[model samples]
Target: MEKREVVVSITDNGPGISEDIQSRIFDPFFTTKPIGKGTGLGMSISYQIVTEVHNGSIQCISQPNQGTTFNIKLPQKYNRVIPQ
Candidate 1:
């Protein structure tokens, strides 16, 4: 989203996820991190809030050894905090 659209993003420089595992990235409690580093629910919950709760969209893009980016799209008028 841009200009008149709502946009949200998350980026990372870690070892990019494999294509086989990409589909499960948003599943609850799914994580590539170590035990203490994460609980793995953050993404699943975030996705739920953006789509089901706020009627927005979320997506992730990644490349091995490069980086990853998460993009979220929504209607500008639906940005409750921005007051368009």
Candidate 2:
């Protein structure tokens, strides 16, 4: 079967994430926010939903003071039976 891919990106103008913490952004329970401000599960859950549930991928690109961007890629075609 032929497969198609889709790419989606989100960009922001706020202060960018540091390189040191970029790798851990998708880790469960990881957060850079102050206590009570965040639970840090957002990215982690997003990662799982894309990569695990949809067989897709996610990435982040950023530089200090240059803002951040999130890139998500998903297959437009999947080898699974659809419910009718």
Candidate 3:
């Protein structure tokens, strides 16, 4: 069967993420913000929803001082039931 997907791209011109931190951005409880300023669950939850619930993919592309981009691809049609 041919795979069909919808792509979403988000970009930011602000200072981009460093290579060291990029790999862990989607990890639960991982954040670079000050202790009281962030819960660190945003990205982790986003990753899970896209990959698990939607059966899709997400990727981050960044270069320090240049910019950052996030690309998400979701299947055009999904048949599986969401987890409880």
Candidate 4:
């Protein structure tokens, strides 16, 4: 499937996270963002949706003071029809 070709990335200009903290960024309810600004479950739930539901993987790239980027690899087509 062409969908197997991994792609997609998200970048942010905000302060980058430390390696220690980055490791846990995808943990349930984990977020570097301030309370109310984010729900803290975004990345965690995203990980599950990509890997478990879509059979894909996600990665983070960052350096202190250099901002952050999230790469998400997913299938182009889903087994279950998704509402547009």
TM-score, model 1 to reference: 0.73
Ranking, lDDT, top scorer first: 3, 2, 4, 1
Candidate 2 lDDT tens digits, 26-78: 99999999999999999999999999999999999999999999999999874
lDDT of 4 by residue, 1-84 (tens): 344445998999888978998889999877777877887788899899999998889999999999999999876664665798
Q: What is the total number of backbone clashes in candidate 1?
A: 0
Report the lDDT tens digits of candidate 3 across residue range 1-84: 889898999999989999999999999999999999999999999999999999999999999998999999999885565798
Candidate 1 segments exceeding 4 Å error: 1-4, 35-37, 78-84
User: Whose lDDT is higher: candidate 1's or candidate 2's?
Assistant: 2
Q: What is the lDDT of candidate 2?
A: 0.94
lDDT (Cα) of model 3: 0.95
Candidate 1 Cα deviation (angstroms), residue 60? 0.6
lDDT of 1 by residue, 1-84 (tens): 554667878799998877767788989999989999999999899889988987888988887897888899975774457655
Model 3 lDDT-worst window of ten: 75-84
For model 4, name the residue pairs that clash.
none
Candidate that would win on TM-score: 3
Candidate 4 residue runs with Cα over 4 Å from true position: 1-3, 33-39, 76-84
